[model samples]
Target: MTPDLFGRHRAVLPDWLALYYEDPLEITHGEGRHVWDAAGNKYLDFFGGILTTMTAHALPEVAKAVGEQAGRILHSSTLYLNRPMVELAERVACLSGIPDARVFFTTSGTEANDTALLLATAYRRSNTILAMRNSYHGRSFSAVGVTGNRGWSPTSLSPLQTLYVHGGVRTRGPYAHLGDREFTDACVDDLKDLLGHTRAPAALIAEPVQGVGGFTSPPDGLYAAFREVLHERGILWIADEVQTGWGRTGEHFWGWQAHGQNGPPDIVTFAKGIGNGMSVGGVVARAEIMNCLDANSISTFGGTQVTMAAGLANLAYLLEHDLQGNARRVGGLLLERLRSVAARVPHVREVRGRGLMIGVELTRPGTDEAAPEAASAVLEEARAGGLLIGKGGGHDTSALRIAPPMSLTVAEAEEGAAILERALRSV
Candidate 1:
C-alpha cells in the first residue's frame, strides 16, 4: 500500500525545499553504510547524508555519548562553564594547525561561516569578500552573498561586495585547457588582476574540494600559490572545510594541507562530519583575528554541552580507530574501481574527488554537454538496485556524488561499485 505521506509532505513543506528523486524516499532507520526505507527496502548508502555521517551509522560510541549526555544535561548555554565544549575545542585547535587557535562552536555550517565572515570583516575593516566560482557556502544571507554559484545564490542583495574568483572548478572553465602549472599561474594572474580593480578585501574564501560543485578541485598547491599573493596584500585566507575536513580527502586531515605551503589559513570553518551526525559546526582562527570583535557575543545554543560531548566522543573514536588511514586505503580502492567503471561508460564524462568524496560527472555521449537527465536516470536506477547516492554540480546537477562512511569495508566498496556500474549501464 503506497502511503499518502508524500502528498502530505508536498502540502506542508515549502516547495523550494529540494528533495531527491521523483518519488522521494523516506529513510526509516540506518546502520553502518546501509539504510532502510519506510517500506522496508534496504539500500547501501553511498552519499552518507551528504558526507555528514563520517563514521558508520549507529556507531556505539556516538550513541553512548549522546545517551549519557542526555541523561545528565541536554544543553547548557555558553554562559555556563561547558567542560565538554572546552575539551573538544582544545582538540580542534590542536588539530587545526593555526597558531594560538581559538575555537567557536555553532550548531550548523551556515552559522560557522557567518561567524567567520563577521570576524574577517571586522578585523580587516572591509566588506569585500572573494569566493571561488561554483562554490556553495551556505543559505544564510551573508553566506549566500559569497556563494559564487548562480543557481544557489537566490538574491543579489548583500552587505558585502563579493568578487568571484577562478580555479575552484578546474575542469570546465576558460583555463581548463591549461596544464597544472600554467593553470596555477593563470589563476594567480587573474586574482592579482581582480584585486587590482577592487578595494582592499577582507578575505579570500575557498573550498579545497567544492562539495556541491560536484567534487571539483584545483590542481594541488593552487591555493598555496594564491595564498602567497593574498599574504602580500594583507588579505586573510579562509578555508571552508565543511566537507573536506577530517581526513575525508585521505591524504590530509584538513583540506588546506593540500595547499599548506602557506602554512595554516587565517581562519577555518568546519562542520558536517566532525560530530558524525550531531549538529556541530565551528570556526578556528588565530588569536588576533578571533579577538577583533569588541562587542559581547554568544551563541545560546552554540557549544551546547550535549553536542560537545558528542563531538569529543566522536573525535576520540575516529582517531583511536585510525579511520583516516582507512579512508586512504579504501578510498584509493574505490576511486580506482570507479574509474574502471566510468571508463566503460560514454555518458560518464569525468570521475573526480579525493578519498570517499567522489563524483562522476555525466555528459551527453561524446560531447561536453552536461547530461543532467542521464545523472537523474542513474540515480533512480541505483536506488532501484538497492544503492543510494547523490547528485550535484554547478551545471544543472550533472554529477553523481558518492561518499560512503569512512569505515567502509573492502567488500562494501566492491558491492556499491557493482551496483553503481549497473545503474550507469542502465542509464
Candidate 2:
C-alpha cells in the first residue's frame, strides 16, 4: 500500500514524543517586527522568535550573504581553513571585549553552553557545577542537568553533582523574604553555606536576566555578591546569554551589561541574535578559561560557510544601523506603556525587565496566586486579534514576554502595548 503525499500517520507526529503545545500561532513570513501566517493575516511580532530575530526576518543583507555563499561553497570540513569562518571568529572576539578571547562556534545555544561546560569542567578538574535555581541554560543532556527547572528531566548523567542556589525563589517560603537587606544577607549566607558544604564546583552558570525564570532581573548587589563568592572560591562563572545577546536589552550589546561591571562572568555563551535567527552559537571566554581546551577537539558543522557569512552580515547590519540605540528608545517606550497598563489593570503583578526584553506579569484578578492561566488567556486573545506574544512559565504564575526586533519603533511599541491592553481587558 502507498502512503499519503504529505505523509502517513500524522498521529505518530502528534503522540510519539514530548511537546510544548502552548506555542504561538503559525508564522509563514516576517519583516521587521511584523509577521504573517499562511492565511495572509498579519500580526505584530513582539516575541522576535523567542529573542532570536532581533534583526527581523528576511533581512536583505543577510539573505544576500546566505544566497551568495550557498552559490559558491556550502560544505567545508574544519580540517580546511575557511575565510568566512576565520573572519567571523575574529570579529566576534574583537567585539566581545576580552582581548585574546577565543570563539568556538556551534549549531545552537545548547551546544554553545555544552561546550562552555566542558571547558569549565576540564579547567577546574571538578564535576560539581553550581547553577542558580530558576536559571535556564539549555536543553541538552548536560545543559538540562545544569538547568534549575525540575520539570525538565534529569540528564543522562544524573549524578553529575549540580548544585543550585536560590535564584529568586526560596524553597522555604514566600519570596517576600528576598526584598530587604536581611533577606539579601540570608540568601548570600545560604549560598556561602552551600559552597562550603559541597565539593569544589567546576563552574557557576547563569542568565544575566533570567529568561525562562519569569524575566526577573537580580536584586541590587545580588550579582556582585554572587561574583565575589564565586571568585573567592575559585568557581568559574559562565553567563548564558542565549536569549539576551546582540543588543536586545538596549543598554549594551549583551544582557550581562545590564548588571553593570559587577556581572562579568568568566565565560559567556551567545546564540539567538548573533546571527539573527541563523543557526550559530558561540562560546567566548577569558583567556585563561579558554586555553584549557585540547587542540584536536572540534565539531564538523560548528561553523559552516553559509552560517558564518550570514553572521558576518548580521553583525555588520547591527553595527551600521546602531540598532542598540533603537532598542533602548523603543524598549523604554514599551516599558512605560506596559507600566501604564499595569497601573490600570488589577491583575498585573509586576512590570519588570529592560529594553526590548520586557515581561508583563499577571496575578489572579483579586488573589495572590500567579495568574499563569490569565497570562495564557491574554496571549490567546492577542493572537485572535492579529498580534503575536509569547508566554514564560515556572515558579510563580506566567508572564507575557515581549522581545521584538531591535528595529522596532516607539510607535510600534505603543501599538503593541495597546493591543496587549485590549487583550488583558477581554481576558
Candidate 3:
C-alpha cells in the first residue's frame, strides 16, 4: 500500500517536492510526540512535521476549536466581518511589538513575506532589498529573490533588485574568525559601504535565526546594530520569524528579541507553527506601513474562520501551558546530550541552536566538505531506531535538524536523543 501510494504521489506531485529517506513512510496518525506509519510502526516525532505541529499532534483545544468553527463556517472572504478572524487579528496586533500595529493575514509564510515585501517597497518607494547570506525567506517570487540559500532559490530573475548581506551564519564566511562585537562592527561597516554604492533600498529582511540554513544565526545584537544603520537612512527592517517566533528559541518570545537593543523590526512575518497544523500566516507592522497600499487587496482564504479559530485555541493552549518553558527545559537537556554524542563522532562538524530548533551539521572526517551522505545515513538509521528527524542546510543539505513539538517532555527528549545518538554512531 505504501509503495502504491508513493507511486501515485510521484505521478501527481511536482518533481521538486522532495521527500525524506530512500523509502518514504506515510504517517497515518499522531498523538503527543509520536506518530504511527501506515504499517503501524510508531516512532518518536522529533521534527514535528517540519516544526508545524508546534504544540502537539491532535491537540484537543485546537481540534475542538477547528471542529466548532467548521460546523459554523469553513471560510468567509476577507471582505466580510469574520468574528474569529477579527479576534485573532486583535491578539496578533497586541502581541506584535510595533506601535499602533496592524495585522494582515495570509495562508502561508510565502504569502506573508510577499505581503511584507509589497508593504516595504510601497512605503519606502524603492525596489532594492537587503537580505542576509545563507538566509531563506520563502518560495514565492518576491521571497525567493531575497533568499540567499542557493538550494532553495530556483531563479535569478526577480522584480526586485536584491543585495545579499553577510553575517547570518556565525561559524562560516569571511568574518567567522572575529569576536562577536568585532564581527558586528565589520558587518555594519559593510552594510554602510553597500548602501553607499546602491540606490536606496526598500528594506532589510532577515531571519534572526536562519532556519533552513542549518539553524545558523549571527551573534546577539548584530541585527540591532544593523537596525541603527538602516533607521538612520529611513530604511525598514523586516524580521522573517516564520520559524523562530512564538518562543521557540527558549530565551525570548521572538527571535528578534535577541537583537532587541534597537526595539522590534519595522515589519514582522510569521507562520508555520501558529495554527498548530492549520494553515495560518500573517504580517504585522506599524499601521502606516500596513496601510501603505494605495489599492485594496483581499485574500480569498487567508483568514478563514476555521483556521483562525484553530490559531486562537492553539495560541491559548501554548501560553497557558507555558510550552516555551517546556521547550527550554527539555531542549537544553537534548542539546547537551547531542553535543556529548557528537563529540565522539568524527563526521559531526557542529551542534548548534537554541531550544527545540537544534541542528547537527555533518562534514567529511577532518575536512570542511559537507557530508550529505552521512546525514542521509543517520536519518535512515534514526528511523530504523524508532525515531524521526529532519535534514537541511545550504546547497548540500548536510545538517541534521531536530525540532520537536514545544510541548516535548523530558522523558521524550531523553528517548529521542538516545535513539539519535545510536543512529549517528551507527552511521
Model 3 steric clash pairs: none
Q: Which stretches of candidate 3 lie over 4 Å from their true place?
A: none
List TM-scores for all candidates, in order: 0.99, 0.91, 0.99
lDDT of 3 by residue, 1-427 (tens): 2789999999999999999988898998999999999899999999988889999999989999999888988987998999998899999888888899999889999999999999999999999999998889889999999999999999999999999898998888899899999999999999999999999999999999998988999999999999999999999999999999998989887999999999899999999999889999999999999999999799999999999999999999988999888888888999999999999999999999999999999999998899999999999999999999998888499999999999999899999999999999987
lDDT for each of the candidates?
0.93, 0.79, 0.93
Question: What's the TM for model 3?
Answer: 0.99
- Candidate 1, which segments miss by more than 4 Å at Cα? none
TM-score of model 2 (CA atoms): 0.91
lDDT of 2 by residue, 1-427 (tens): 1135114334456543332224424468988789987668898988877888878788999999999999999869687898999999998888776657888889899999999999999899998988877777777888888887654545447535798887454222345545556656777788899988888898888887878776776655565677788888788878788988877778888766644455467788998887888889999998878888676676788889999999999999998999988988888988988898888899887788887888777888776577877887888888877778777746443778888888887788888888999998886
Model 2, total clashes: 0
Model 2: CA > 4 A from native: 1-24, 154-159, 168-184, 260-263
